[model samples]
Target chain A: MNEYTFPIVFGVFIGVVTRLYLLKTDYRQYPTYLHGKIIHIALGFIAAGLGTIAVPAIMEKEFAAITFLALAASQFRDVRNMERNTLNELDQYELVPRGKPYIEGIAIVFEGRNYLVIFASFVSTLAYLVWNIWAGVIASIIGLLVARKFMSGSRLKDIVDIEYVEPHFEGAGLYVDNIYIMNIGLPARQKEILRYGMGFILKPKNFNARSTIANLGQRQAILHDISTALGVYRDSGTPALVPLAKRDLDDGRVGIFILPQEKDIEKAKTIIGNVPTLENAIRMPTKSEANKKGRKLR
Target chain B: MTHEKLILAVITTNSNKIAGGAPIFTCDTREEMESVATNLEAILDGIAHSLSDELLIIVKH
Candidate 1:
């Protein structure tokens, strides 16, 4: 086997395999169609080729070929914007909308993943060129493990304690674990809520988690994910049935109320637990002087 | 607070006519009506807005 050709092919194969493995996650369940999968996989193959070809180009003293990396960077950024646009358009029709923060987070993750694939292929090819094919295989495994670790970010459950709570209405006001949510006007609607609704209390484990949960965008993401996974019970123009998340000012705990069609509490909890914490929604209390003084800021 | 009567507010963009049996505020733009409705909803009970029908409703109970 020729050194250059075999290493390049193996590197590309490993890179594409790693990319496909990472794409098998459950969060951000969009672009599920066969066409969408094909597009991403094709892009991953291109990224792998770019990385694997760089080693041969450099070995041949063709330094100008490195410019292709810059092109790939810009192309991936376009991928980010495309993801943001598609998700934003889809958000309009969602019963529990994934807010802007969640969409931005998803877009950034997708862009970063392409770069990871490139890195994996580049490292694998370099190891093969230096030593042997066996060494390249080991390098590929290590590269994939690192990429997989980077892919799994902190979830809401990692930072906060999520517990199922009883949903009840005190007079006309809805309450979840003593935190007041919204008010229900119609008795029939209230009856429906009591019958089919599930409630949860998100108790922040620490200051960092508290501020994160306090973010309206973060709470909306949590509600959207759970509602989407468990199936929300609202149609267009039905405002009362929309999922709501309200924070208790006295404490940092947040209350969530959702009317899901399936009413599967276990599935809802699992979905909520798996929601990736939005990057923009994380607020560090110690970073600001006002927060250091224990002044609560939402 | 328990014995007090609930207050309700209705904000609508439809200037043609106000619905019967309730005092409602009319605004030229949907933004203004939504602001009024949201503020009322926060203080009182709840708010519901319909974009297609052009209605901003505030309910208190």
Candidate 2:
């Protein structure tokens, strides 16, 4: 049995591991500080290089070699520090632009100093790899994980210009949708209640002023869903529930007048045809003994 | 006020030539919703525009 057989196996494993690391994780997109750790790497390589000549000059050949070895070891230690510093900095959001880390990760393996450390560690170790080799793999996995956490699943800009284009129609008909998404689970005691902006528009099919007012009152109870769907304005800290942002009408239509309940009714009067008050008005959901899932307008 | 009034406003946009009669009334208050039918006076200026055949009726009541 070869004593070195186990070591050889371990060596191959480390080599494969280090090579695999270079293959993955593009570090080019990482922030300047992260990639800037090139300073530590450069210093490490410079020391490694200078040690080759300087250590031989300082003492006997064997002693010089040992000194160079020690220097090389310290340089590796510094490289590990730099790697770790880079990892720590990259842990947060927007730490880097995004794509840089993905691009430069492979290049790290090709560098002469990292390559030297990777091979030597494999050659010398019977079992354990150099600490940074293990750390490098760990740091890479962590970086990848951290990067994914910062990346957004969807962009808000894509959903912005929402157009609900409908088929063209003539005569008088109406299309209405509420302002906000209904969240029923909301506790009533909470001051911030869900507001649904109600929307209603009229097309003059056969303009009968009298029947329209009477019928509108009758339909009040059913319009609870429409009212609840109205959107609330989040202006001046208080949410104003405004249903209609805009309106359009054809010629041949005439509005009677507006009947305002309060002072600010003028704003509303100008927007819709004058106000017409029905006998029964809209009311929110009342306090009930039973658990009420249904609406209040009814 | 404990009994705060719930209001509703409806706006209509129509072309000038097509619009006729009194302007409809819409309100900031839900209670005044029915008052609009009684008013025969065309409060709104007829939307007698230059070219468009659409009429507008901004109703608040």
Provide the overall lDDT of each model, using Cα atoms, as 2-decimal numbers. 0.81, 0.30
- TM-score, B chain alone, candidates in order: 0.63, 0.20
- Model 2 superposed RMSD (Cα): 24.2
Model 1 C-alpha lDDT per residue in residues A91-115, reported as the tens digit of each score = 9887788999989998898888898
Best by TM-score: 1
lDDT of 1 at A270: 83
Q: Comparing to the true complex, what docking class would candidate 1 get? A: incorrect
Task: Kindly list the per-residue Cα lDDT of model 2 for residues A1-298, writing each as its tens digit.
Answer: 4533444344444444333333333323222454454553444344334333332233333554445555556655655555545544453332111122322321232343444434433333422233424553454345334333432222211211112222111222212322221111112201222122223333333223223322333223112112222212323212211222222333222222111122133333233332222222222223343425444322
Model 2, which residues run further than 4 Å from truth?
A1-27, A30-41, A54-65, A94-112, A115-298, B1-61
Q: Each candidate's interface RMSD, rounded to one decimal?
A: 9.9, 18.8
Worst 10 residues of 1 chain A by lDDT: A25-34
Which whole-number lDDT from 0 to 100 does residue A90 have in model 2?
A: 56
DockQ, prediction 1: 0.06
